[model samples]
Target chain A: MSEHGERSAPGKGLVNGLAVTLKTMTRRSTTQQYPDVQPELPPRSRGVIALLEENCTVCMLCARECPDWCIYIDSHKEEVVVPGAARARQRNVLDRFDIDFSLCMYCGICIEVCPFDALHWSPEFEYSELDVLDLLHDKDRLGAWMPTVPPPPAHDVLGEPSKEEATAARKAAGPGAPTAARTARARPETPEPGK
Target chain B: MPLWLDLLVRVVAVVAAFLVLPLLVGQAEHKVMAHMQGRLGPMYAGAFHGWAQLVADGVKFVQKEDITPRDADRRVFQLAPVVALFPYLIVLLAIPLGPGGLVAQPLDVGLFFVLAVLGIGVVAVLMSAWASANKYSLLGGLRGAAQLLGYELPLVLAAASVAMAAGTLSLPGIVEAWSPWWLLWQAPAALVFFVSGLAEIRRPPFDMPIADSELVFGYMTEYTGLRFAFFLLAEYVGIIVIAALTTVLFLGGWHGPAAEHLGWLWTLLKVFAVSFVIIWLRVSYPRLREDQLQRLCWLVLVPVALAQLVLTAAVKVAL
Candidate 1:
C-alpha cells in the first residue's frame, strides 16, 4: 500500500534515485573560485593573529596568557618629559614582537584577555611557506596584517548599549565636546536606566 | 590496387580509431562529467581548458617506475595488457562508420566477428587478475569472469532481436534494412542491450569486478606504470566499441538525410551520443552489489531479452 493509501508502487525508489541525480546535474555548482576571488569571511573569523602596534603597551599580558607561549615581546624603559609634572616619566617602549605561528594553537585567548584591544584576529590566512621557520612572523608582519582585520560587527539595537559606547556617548553629552557630539547624534542609543 | 597497401591503410585506420580517438573521448568524458557535476575539470595544461592534460598524464605515467609483484607470474603479468588492448581494434575494423556500407572489411559475418573479438579482452582481465596472485585480484577476476559471462548472453539476445526484426546479422546490412529506426521497433531489446553492454564493459551500475571501495581496484590492484595504463585504455576503447556497436545496431548507423555524404559524421554523433548516455548512467546509478549484479543479469535482463526475442519473431512472422 502507498503511504497515502491511494497507490503503492514497486521500484519507485529507483525512479526517485535517477530523478535526484538529474536534478543535481542541472543545479548550479557551489564551487568557490578560490585564489581568483576572495571568499566572504565573517568579521571576527580567527584566521591569523594581528597586532595594533600603537595600542600594544608591551604589558606582556598577551604572552603570559597564551597557552602555547607563541607570543614573544621585548621592550626597554624609555624616559619621557612631562610638562608641569614630575621631571621625567618612564614607560615601556616596544622593541621586538614576534609570534611563532608554528607553535600557535589559535585558541583566541590572547585576543580575549587583551585589556587594550591591541590583538585582533585577521581573516587573511594564506601564509603557507615552504619552510616551518618562515612562519615565525615578526612585529612588522603582524602589524601589517592589522589592516586586513575587518571592523567588529554592529551592536544589537534592542540590547543595552556597550560600556565603550555608553562612555563615549556620555563624553559627547558633556559640555565642550564638539567633534564626538556629531558621532553621538548619528547613533541613537536608548538611555540605560541604571546609567 | 595492391592488397598489402589496402591492408596497411585499414590497419592505420583501426589504429587511429582505437588509439587516437580515445584521447579525444577521454577529454570529452572529463569535460562533460565536470560540467554535469558543476566544476571545471581541467584548466591548466594546454592553457585553453586543459587540452593537453591527457598528454601530460600520459607523460607522467610513462615516467613512473614499472613495479612488479615479488612472486607474480612475470610473463602473464607483462603480456595481459597487450592481450587486453589488441583485439578491440580489430573489432573496430569490422564496424561500419558510414552509409553505403563504408567499412574496412565489411565481411559477411562481421557482427559475429566483432562480438567474438570484443570478448577476448575478458581473458586479458582474468590473466592480469590471476597473474597478480593477490587474493583481491583473484576475487576481482572471478567477479569479472562471472559478469562477462552473465552479461554476454543478454547482450547477444538483444542483438538477436535486432537481427530478427531486420532479418540480417551483418552490421551495415542491418543499417540498410532499418526503415524508421531500430530503437522504435526494438526499444526493450535496445534497453537490454545497452544495460547488458554496460555490464560487459564492467562500467558502473555493474562494476562489481573492480569495486574500488571493496576490492581495492580489483584485478588492477598490483599493476603499476604502463601496464595499468594499458588496462585503462582497454576499458575506454571497450566503451568506444560498445558505442559503435549500439550506433550500428539500434540508432540506424549513418542513416540520416544526406548520410551518403555526411555518413561518417552522423556515425560519430550517434556513437558519442551513446557514450554520453553511458556516462549519464555512470553519474546517476551507484554500483550494483555482486549479488545484485547477478540478479539483475539472470533474473531481469535475460528473461526480458528472451521475451523481446519471441515478440520480435512474432512481429516478423505477422508482418
Candidate 2:
C-alpha cells in the first residue's frame, strides 16, 4: 500500500463512515435563492431581444442573418430624386419587419449582423405564455422597447453594482454615457453602411 | 388512543420530524458556509435569507418529470430512493432526541439498532447504482458498499466502547446514567464515533461515491426529477441523523447547562450546536482522494477505535 494508504488505512473505516456527515457539514453548495435575492447573470448575457427602433434604418440585415429564420421583413422600393443628384436613388421603404421571437435562440447574430445597430439584448427573461404563437413578435410588437434590464443589486451575491446606484451614476455622467468599463468593453464594433 | 393508532401517530411524528429537521439543517449548513466564506447565504427565497428555498426546491422537484433510463431496471431503480430514505426514518425511531423525544420503544439495543438501520442506506445506494445500469452508478454503488464495509467496524467499535462505559445499550438509560454527561467520561469513544460517523455518511474528504466531479452523482446518475430529489433528501436526512446521533451518544443526550430545568430547548440547542460543528468542518476542509480515504479509515480510525474500546474495557474492570 502507498504511504497515503498505509497512513490512512487503520483510520480508513472511521473516515469513510464520517465522510458523508463531514460533507454535509462542508462543501460549497449549488443553490441560490432567487425570489428574495435574484442571481446575477454575467455581463453580455443574451437573454431577450429588444429592438431600438430609433436606431433602426430598416436595413433588414437582422432578418437575413437569423439562422432560425424567425425574422420576417417586407419592404417596397420608392424612388426619390435629389435636386442636385445626377440620377434618382431608390430607397427601400420598410413596409414590414416582423421578428418571431418564438423561434429566436437569442444567438445575437441578428443583433451583430444589423448594420443599423437596431437590435439589442434585453435582460428580461420572465416572458411566459399560454400559447406558443404569443411569442411570435411582429414588426409593431418588436418595435417596442423592452423594460431596462435591472442592474445588479448592490447587495447582490454575484458581485455587481445595484441597478439604482448604476442608474444614478449614469444619470450623473449624462444621458447615454458609458455606465461601467465592463459594459463599455462588451460593445460590438458598429458595422459600416453599404457594405 | 388504541395501540395501533398510537403507533401510527408515533410513526407520523418520526417521519415529520425526520423530514423537517433535515430541511432546516440543510438550510443552516448553507447559511453557515456562506457566513464562514464571507458571503450572505439564501437571503431571497422567503423573508429571512431564503428560508423558503427548500420548499421551493421541493415544489420544483415534485413538478419535474421523473425520468428513468430506458435500459434501467425500472422497479429497482424506482425502489432505490425509498430504500435509501426508509432506513433513516427507521433509525430516527430509536434516537432519543430528548427525555421524552423518542417516538418508538427505547430498545435495550438502541445503539446497535440505529447503526444497523443506517447500514441499510448503503444497500439502497447499491441497488440504485445496479438498477440504473450506468457505469458511474455501478462505480458509485460499489464505492458506497466498500466504504460502508470499511467504516462500519470502527463505528461499531466506537459505539461498543460508549455502551461499555455507560453500562447500557438503551439510549435513554445511557443518558440517565451520565451525571454531567457521557462525553466527559468517554471522550476517546466520542472522537472515534464522530470520525466514523462522518465516514459512514460518505462526507467530504471521504465523499468519493457521489463526487460530482468524478461520478456525476454515482448511483443517481440515471435518476432524474423527483427520484434525484429523493436521493438528495436522503443524503441531507442522513447528515441530520448523524448529527443527532452524535449528540445522543457522546454529548450527553439532552444534558447541558441547566438542561433538566430548560426542558427540550436545551436538547434542541445541543443538537443544533453539533449540527453546526459538522457544517463548519465541511466549510473548513477540501475533499480527500479515494485511495487516501480508504487508507485513512482502515489504518487510522480502526486502530484508534479499537484502542479506545480496549481502554474502556480496562477502565470498566478497574472501576
Candidate 3:
C-alpha cells in the first residue's frame, strides 16, 4: 500500500484494471449449484462420524477416550452355555450406543481410540437438525451413515503395505510362512554411510 | 395524429421506458458485476439467467415492513423517496429517443431542463439525511451535497461544450447536428462528462456518500421496504439518465446507419452499451476516498472540462 508510486504513464493503472475486469467477464464463472447439483467431496473427507455396529464388541475405549465426552455406551452381560461343557460363559451385549453430535467437537479422538474398527468418517454432512436433541445420533442413526463413508485414499506408490493387508497376506501364506521375529532378525541392520 | 392523442401516446411511452429501462439496467448490473467477479449472480429468479431478478426484488420489497424511526421527522422522512425518484421521470421526458420530435415533452432548452431537473435529486438526499435523525444519514447527506458541488460544474461544463458544438440546447437538435468526426473532436469533453455524470449519480468509485461499509447506506440508512425500493429504483434511473445523456450529447444518439428507420433501436443500443461500461467501471474500481474524490473533481475533471470548453469555442469560431 504505497501512497504514491512512480508511474511512467498517468491513468495506466486505471486502464489496466478495466482490462482485467473485461478479461474476467469473458472467463467462465466458478459457481457451483449446491442444492441442484451435489458437490464432489474429496475421498475420505471428514463430514460425519459413522458406526459399524456389527464390528463393535461393547468396548468402552471410544466412549472413555472422547475429549468432548459426547459418546455414550451401555451394555448388559449375556450368559451362553458351552457346547460340550457344563460351564457357562458371560459375554457383553451392546444395549445402547449414542453420540451426542450437538456436543461432539469432531476431534476424531473417539474414532482413533476405538479398539475395534467400529467407527469411520462419512463424507455426507447434510444432517442439520431443528432441535439440538435431534442431533444426538443413536446407534441406528449412526449405522445409517456408514453407507456414505468413502473408501480410504490410496497410499503413496512407494509406501509399505497396510497393517490389515499385511496380516491378511501372512494368513494366506499358511503356518510355514516366515514369522515376524524371524524376518526381523534375518534382515541385518546396515551401518551408516559415514560410519 | 391528433395533438392530444399524440401527446398522450408519447407520455405513455416515456413512462413505460422510465419504469422498465432502469430495472433492465439494474438486472444487467447484477449479471455483469457477478461475471466480472467470477460468480453466477441470481441464476434462478426468472428461471433463465435471472432475467426477472429485479422484478422479484420489487415483489420482495413490497412484502417488507416499512419502518419510521421514533425520533425522525415523520412527514419529510416519508416523502424523501418520492422526491428522490420524481425528478428522473421529468428528466426522462425531455430526453429524445430519436429525431423528428421523438421526445415526451420536447422542451426548447432540453439540455438546461435535464441538468436542472437532475440537480433536484440531491435535495431528496438532503431531506432524507436531515429527517432520518441519524448521524450516518446526516454525514451521507452532507457528502452528497459536497459531491454534487464538486462534480456538477464539470458535468454541466462538459455538456455545455457539446451544446455549443451543436449550436443548440435541445437534445434532439444536438443529435441532428452530430457528425461521426465529433467522436474524436468531443472526446475530452465526453470523458469529462461521463466521469462527472458517474460521480453525480454516486456510482461506485465515487460512492463515498453511501459507502456501505462506512455510512450504512448513507442518506438511505433509515429507509426500508417500498420506500427503500424507491431509492434503489432512483439510483438505477440515475444510471440510465446519465448513460442516455452521455449517449445523446457525445456518442451521437440515434445517428447510426439506417437510423431513420431504426433510430430508437440505435438509441437504446447505445444506452445499454454505456450502461454496461458503467457497470464494468463499478466492478473494476474500489470506492475513492472522500478527499481523493473531491481532488479528482476539482483538480482533474474541472480543468479538463474547461480545456474542452475552450476547444469547443475555438472550433465553433473557426467554423
* Candidate 3 CAPRI classification by DockQ: medium
Quality class of the docking in candidate 2, CAPRI style: incorrect
Better model by DockQ: candidate 1 vs candidate 3: 3
lDDT of 2 by residue, B19-135 (tens): 898898889877877766656677768877689988888899999989888999999999999998888888878877667644366788898888888889788988999999899
Candidate 1 Cα deviation (angstroms), residue B236: 0.5
Superposed Cα deviation of residue A146, candidate 2 (Å): 20
C-alpha RMSD for every candidate: 4.6, 10.8, 4.1
Model 1 reaches what TM-score against the true structure? Answer: 0.89
Candidate 1 chain A worst ten-residue window by lDDT: A175-184
TM-score of chain B of each: 0.97, 0.94, 0.98
- Looking at model 1, residue B162 earns an lDDT score of 89
Best by lDDT: 3
User: What share of the reference contacts survives in each candidate?
Assistant: 0.47, 0.00, 0.94
Candidates 1 onward: DockQ, in order: 0.45, 0.04, 0.77
Evaluate candidate 1 and give its CAPRI docking class based on DockQ. Answer: acceptable
User: What DockQ does model 1 achieve?
Assistant: 0.45
